[model samples]
Target: MNNNEHLTKRRGMTAEDLLRLRSVRDPHYAPDGTRVVFVEKSIDEENQYRSHLYMWTKDGAVRPWTFGPWRDTKPRFSPNGETIAFLSDRSGRTQLWLLPTDGGEARQLTFFKNGVRDYVWSPDGTFLIALTTLGDDETIEDREEPEKAEVKRADLKPRVVERLYYKSDAAGFLDGKRAVLARIDALSGKIEALTGREEEIGSFAISPNGRTLAFVANRNEDPDTTFTRDIILLDLEKKTEMNLTNGCGTFASLGWSPDGMKLAAIGHDLAYLGATIHRLYVFELERQTKRVLTADWDAHLGDAMVGDTHADAKSPGPIWASDGSGLYVTASERGRVNVYFVSLDGPIAPVVEGDFHLYGFTVHPNGRQAVAAISSPTSIGDLYAVSLADGTKTRLTRANEALENEVVFADAKPFTYQSTDGWEIQGWIMKPPELGEGEKAPLVVEIHGGPHAMYGFTFFHEWQLLASRGYAVLFTNPRGSHGYGQSFVNAVRGDYGGMDYEDIMAGVNAALNRFDFIDKERLGVTGGSYGGFMTNWIVGHTDRFKAAVTQRSISNWLSFSGVSDIGYFFTKWEIGCDVWEDAERLWHHSPLKYVQNIRTPLLILHSERDYRCPIEQAEQLFIALKRLGRETKLVRFPDANHDLSRTGSPALRLERLRHIVGWFDHYLKGPFG
Candidate 1:
């Protein structure tokens, strides 16, 4: 039962092995604390990720609580511990389903026309509140109407955009529908609309007394221009809502105190724009006042690294203690995610500290124990019981035993070196497993997507695949990456390809100097998003690398600012200027402006529906390179968005892996003849 057994005499890892790995996520301890319920995710034969709840105990006994091929997630134990409520798509649409913990047939709770997006049980266990988007029509006929309209392609009408925020990478075209919060009775199955027609709810949480709710929303006249959001307190009985933050700052992760006398949440004042560090705050319900708890903390409060390929990654919000003394929260600091204890009076300390990333965790009622989902470079992911008192983490489930037994995972070795400007940069190198004596392997310098996201010890399937294929993978945290101080993460702003590029190149030189087995002559570079931008920039600026692959990249900032879903605000926020204001500066930073200098063979991967960077980014690069008679190829994934590599179709993910491996092998590894 050793977790590292697969590293012993195991064969190389393959992309197909990714399907066999079972992902463990969303572990919720029953109210009694005797048993735990979690979702075990696996790739089904039909190329879909299927998740079902499994009942687990402290003694290592495990059994399936729900049997289904459909996706079932977010299992929660009722406050009374009598019933388990979860979201499922078993009825063809995702809806809330309730099942008695003692064992019985499950009952469908709600059948809304648009289906439920998210739901949470009231503290009394009497009502279930859910968030969903509704159309202009609010009649019974509209409520029962199916979401999919049967219309021929030729008969489709033109889509008109009347809002500035007309599209999103996750939801596609904005339907002009508002997301409303609705309440459903646990027994009678009666539905009640709690929000007005135009009230658009973002995120919410019910009070411990089930009397009031705290939710986030953008109620400004023009939400597109307004970057700030406020937390609103809604009284269920009185049906009156009051703005709590009063435009103080952007707030989210709402949590009610045990006594329902205070509210705890996390957010920032946009001091650093998109890269601003988040701080925890507490609002006094009785006094109608608020105070910042983690104002001095410099690290990002929640998990924003985003390297995990696991399909069921859950966001662990701030968990309030039973006695209302303090709350537990997850924070990303220096390439690791750790849970911290923060008191209302401004005392903050780490509860669980480690190099590994704790993506999700659930605090028990006792406040000393928690079930956490952890992932590292050597291991995919597993559930563990974390003792908050002594910092002891006990493995609770071995969900990926098949992957561990068959794949020899290459562990990332930490390293640090000063960049060209003497700024210290942290990085990791994953050497190819079992390399022969005196044999140097081809090196692949990897860059992370978010220039703001840090490349840490999280288990990355794509990196493992490349390492297994005899390529030493090198990745580093540059100036813009999180986990560092605010000043460091903000260094890349207004200097897209400036010092950050020098930091990455310096990291590569350090890795090559430290590892003699890395063949510098057969080096390669690749990245997505900001990483992709760096990849394109790297090739256009220098011919040091023999090959490069840019996925879902941004080539021209000027065009991107106009076409990208987030480019309008994102460009102005991250780049420090608008396209109309400083077109010359945008062109100067764009890789497309210097496309004629690219000498390395480039592989461009993009999704057709990618609204983030927009496929036009890739197209612009490919067309420019091809027109110049350069070695470049474009691979477009259909029906996929910006997250193609991580959450796209299983078959498409594997195909992407093959293409990457094939492209690298052709240029850096092999002689097909």
Candidate 2:
């Protein structure tokens, strides 16, 4: 009975172990850095999710360069490393394909009409540049009729809404189709229209003497009532255009400098609007001059770490360093998301610091190496390599290493305390892997949803399925999160439910005075979208949670400043006011104006196309908690959005993790019969 206790038995993590976790994502490299590629994803036994394209190799050989059951993704590579391109959906829609590295057979470039929402590779490998979406009288020769570009009907046309940024909990109703930027013909796929501009472009780069491109848009004059992104540049062979942040601020990931005379990016200047932070600027394309490079660095540069498994992870923005010597970027800090480097004369450092979650990277054309992707609190993501001269790493893709050799996850820990005005915060916890000696358990808490995103060390399958059912999870980062800087994320913008609900109840009394097997009367709580408006403002201001769920929430900032979709400038930028400038200061920062002082037992869950907190804010908190009878419920999901628990629909993200572990095991384990 001892082959090391049968190879270390294992068990815990379930909710169908999120269909055996995989994810990986956007690695790239291969312009002769000895190949890398990436993508992975997973889920199928009919619960669907798929995504392919692999590769790896620096002799640690990995393989699978695209397989069927389509959904391949952003690969890239090509500047004569002989083709890779990517973004697939195997022809039924998301186009731009390619493949080739020494072999053959992977063609289909871009038929347009609606597919390909991003591309790139044009440092002189005969162009590719993409990003699609057309209609204002569409054309790319009306997508050359592949049966009218694979017809799919169901338009039912009636969205005539005139933009105040019409719909997007990830592309839902923006049907006036704008995005643009074309070019193609990477060996005759033909395409053309590179920026017919009407403002939608956002994030682009191209220039290493490929005659400039640079991008990021917002051509003002009602580009959806302004956040003015600017950047511009253009001139791909004298088509001429210039701007470069004249609209002054809110930029995006752009990069560019191998000697094309600088450009970097990642932005800000709405100075604490949606809780600002995002620094590192550097422009100078021949004296159009700009500089910031982390003006006295504070954190929040690219990957603001919040997890639910890195799905579609792509944010290695400002990478440069092949000889530009100063780029890399990934930032976030305090709860970790590392990879720093910066230096365009200023300093910055930390080329990959620790406690996990790097979330995508690339470099290595000998900038001494990088690859990355990472993830941790028990790895549900892979691809490593690293080094960049002494941080070391290696790993590379055991995808989920047989779901970590059959389950058992839990880890987290990390602490820190002081809340309200003493400030500090930053949390974590976890516990319960089958608790026993002095047994106690049951606790939950888990909030994250970008009160400007941060929760740290990645891999969170609903906090390891509530610490594998025995609960005790916790999670923190309060006071408007995002790696603790820019005034603690603009101190939760104008204080919604003030002091970020007392920094998440002082991180649940600092995890019940630093965990003594947690239990404090078996609590429970949840979150989603501003942590589901702070789990409906912590059960309408504390009954000390004996269960609550919330998801994709927000309960009435006066009908969420007119039905959400960034609710009229995110309710005047995070409740500073505006329903005609103070609908009683957004009902004194709403949670359905303290829903009759709720008494826990909630649930809610939402997402019938949540246009970001818009399942009518979970049907007005389940019809005002069923007209005050309380012990509420709700559910929803159909064609979900507001990313139903991160990139939804893999059987509704496993039935929203079994309705959040069956409503915290029916009111913290003891009722349900």
Candidate 3:
């Protein structure tokens, strides 16, 4: 063999050969703003899943900070920059740990016996706030005691319901206990229970003086905004609470000034109909007054949600300057959220712009430096630093060289499809680069979760792999997908699988009709969670596809309400009714209701540790498929969750891609791979 042939041999010619590959996500900046920290995951020669934390000198000098077989994630620097806290399961249970920046043995902090899911340090750097299910032995036993019981001072007066979307794939009848917040001292190591209310705490922050905490919570908010939450200010010393935003809608993003005199939040554009605006409001804390930052400018609502819950792709809506000179918020043009600076009192200007989505930016106390997670539709997120004044950006991490090495598919051909009733739907076509002998390639119709979520131009690892392997992949943002206006996003809120099914089918039809290379005889469908439910619904509705894979999907809405978390809220907000009141709606929407109609060879992929969608949903589907005497196989991923495809153990994530590719290859692309 020639030298070039030997070089090609050394290189990975097939996708399977690309084992020494990894991807970076959730890039966070250190407190000093001079360095960056991110998680790197890769498979070894033996294909073992390995992950480690790596640091970069803002100029891009990258190296590992931790070394071991165990996984490490969620690294956050203390405000003082002396310690970094993160979650690790090295001790067999995911727990919080503190480590010195100079790097040595990371000392484990929390030992609750079970595990901890989320944690954050207070602004004063003296305390740490953590959230974990207080279902501990002591707590559970305490609940068992009748002494804790109290009269219902105020009844919940739960409302009735009447729609399909009411029953979530995760929580069916939707009645489960909610999570609460707890606090711990960073130095003293003392712990305290902050709230005993059975309501979910969304996001929170510490006031400048560190005496009060503001969080978007459902502690005592209105019942109608179950899908939403209100901002609550809890005075720590006084132990008093005040509800700020009232019971409006869901609030996901917020920013606080250096002095804590003002607060900015990104939320509903309730001022106008068909307008999806993320209104940034500045509330004077003491005066109790609110002022709109973009009061003069036309609001930017980036998605197809009710009143634009989609953030501006350009900015994340607001991170304040250390000097309190201005605020940084994700600004958007269409489908892009770029980090941009807006003066506190002047026109909101773009310090950053382009077709990219941004996140995890930290502003320097000096105001000269900032680091953000930056990525475009064609690229994966890596660490980047930008000058807040000039908006000059420097890429700091080369997380993935796989995309550059392999001719991974990225560009999508945009097209729209019309439903049976003439509703125009958007879809994308991704084709392989190598087409030989005018052969028709197999097709895989992939669906996205978050019936309200938009499937847009974001980079997807599995989709790229599928396209690279010679399948014409078709995906779309149907009526319920975001990035369009609110009317479109909420279109499926009450109907879910009904019109939404037709919308997706129309896209598949469009792909088959518009693209001559698609082989109709060799077609497959797959999706996760909501997509899973839709896939089950699709199979029962029609026998068009030869095979299907449904991952983390809901088979029965009625069962989901109780089995899944957030059951109480899930049934009400989306469906507008309780399971009993809308029994027919739940039945009509369930994929199991028509399981007998499923003839396509099906595969059920689920993670046992998935709390968001729960593994039981997958179990039910697998059982139903087996009982029907249909061709089906179940791939159970242990210790993984609903976000498995995107952020699970690297080896398992690749395994997921492998199984997905293997299934379609078996049914669609002739199985040789």
TM-score of each: 0.97, 0.34, 0.77
- Estimate every model's Cα lDDT from 0 to 1: 0.87, 0.82, 0.68
- Superposing every Cα of model 3 onto the true structure, what RMSD results? 7.6
lDDT of 2: 0.82
Worst ten-residue run, lDDT, model 1? 138-147
lDDT of 2 by residue, 1-673 (tens): 8544543488788888877788887888887788888888887788788889889888898998877788888888778788888888776788888878888788897888788778788787787788888778887666634445443568445568877787888888876788888888887787778777566887887887788888898888877878868888889888889888888888888878888888888898887777888898888877878989787887888787777778457777878788886888888878888888887886778977899888888877878878888888887778889888788887877887877887778889888899868888888898977677698898888888878878878888878878888888888888788888888888778778888889889889878987899879888888888888888988888897788888888888888778888888888887777888678888878888789999888888888888877888788789988999989889898988887677787788888889888878877886731
Error of 3 at 584 (Å): 2.6
Q: Write the per-residue lDDT of candidate 1 for residues 612-657, one digit (tens) a residue.
A: 9999999999999999999989999999999888878889989889
RMSD of each: 2.1, 22.9, 7.6
lDDT of 3 by residue, 100-134 (tens): 99867898776653456677788868888776555
Q: Which 10 consecutive positions of candidate 2 have the poorest summed lDDT?
A: 143-152
Question: Which scores better on lDDT, 2 or 3?
Answer: 2
Best by lDDT: 1
Question: What would the TM-score be for candidate 1 when compared with the true structure?
Answer: 0.97
List runs of model 1 lying over 4 Å from the truth.
Answer: 1-8, 139-150, 197-200
